[model samples]
Target: MIALGVWQLQRKGEKEALLALYERNRAMSSLATYPELPPVPDELLFRKSSVVCLDPVRWDPRSGTDVKGRSGFRMIADCRTGAEGPGVLVDVGISDDFTPPAWTGGIVQGTVVPGPEQPTLVERLTGRAVAARPMLVADQPVAGLRQSAIPSGADVPNNHLAYAVQWFLFALAALTIYIFAVRRRLRQ
Candidate 1:
């Protein structure tokens, strides 16, 4: 029982450390600075000052409930350098625009803020505006030449404390059962 309790404490400590690391990373400046030019960085692996352009693509929206037991729209965008080079597929949120390329290409310039919320996307999935709407991709510009918003990494790590407590309770129950059994056998 004592050993189990100790293990639970250790697990809690590890989880705490992980949560702290994530928080620290989130607090860092959301700068999109990158040294490399053109050549696409690994998907979701970009540094600051990196320039990314998305080719025309279509994807589902994030807000709507999925009849097939899945929610969120799909947006497919191609990441690449120059006109013809290595291109990578970027799956962005449904609130983002991931429509096909128009006569004017979409270009976004900003410090690559790390995390999923670095580049915020907004779109109306339901209602009359949906069908005649532009699917927003991760890198696509929002609202006609307007800069996209980036969400803070505030709510990224969630429910750690609750999880730790649950684990601790389980360990405690196990210890209690063991002690009760031992006492009963001794009396017998």
Candidate 2:
């Protein structure tokens, strides 16, 4: 139990550091260009970036929240940056229409953010690593839609310290109870 508490403390420190790094990169005013797969820099997450999507393969309408926190549908464009490569997802905007729009493709300016998390069970099933893909949340809404929320690294949960405290409390309670039980046995 004590070891678990210590581990949570370590996790808290790591999460803080990651959030700091994300903020530092996002603070820059310069816009970064899209990189072709060779494993781009991890710092690219949460940074301002622009991508010229040559072709929008498909438009996915997903249930999401807008900038104003209104629950609705958001249009995600699955684009092929060039002739062929890894598809980059761009959250074009929020709309009431659950159906996809007629958007083809263009230069999309947005804040680079971490994409949706993939289920860990998928990686275990396939015996491979399946991580969240990087996505861009547009600074402006496309034609008829409204603005989608631009997320920050601070959005990541940081409750590890609180969890650590809970574990430590449990350990202390167990010890105290055991001591009382020993004293009662001696008296008997």
Cα error of candidate 2 at position 62, Å: 2.8
Best by lDDT: 2
User: Model 1: per-residue lDDT, tens digit, 107-183?
Assistant: 54433333222222343333322212111224443333222333323434455455556767887898899999999
lDDT of 2 by residue, 100-157 (tens): 7677888898988767644488686888855667788899888888899888887888
**Residue pairs whose backbone atoms clash in candidate 2:** none
Model 2: which ten-residue window has the lowest total lDDT?
31-40
Global lDDT of model 2? 0.82
TM-score of each model, paired residue for residue: 0.46, 0.86
Model 2 TM-score relative to the real fold: 0.86
Predicted structure with the largest TM-score when compared to the true one: 2
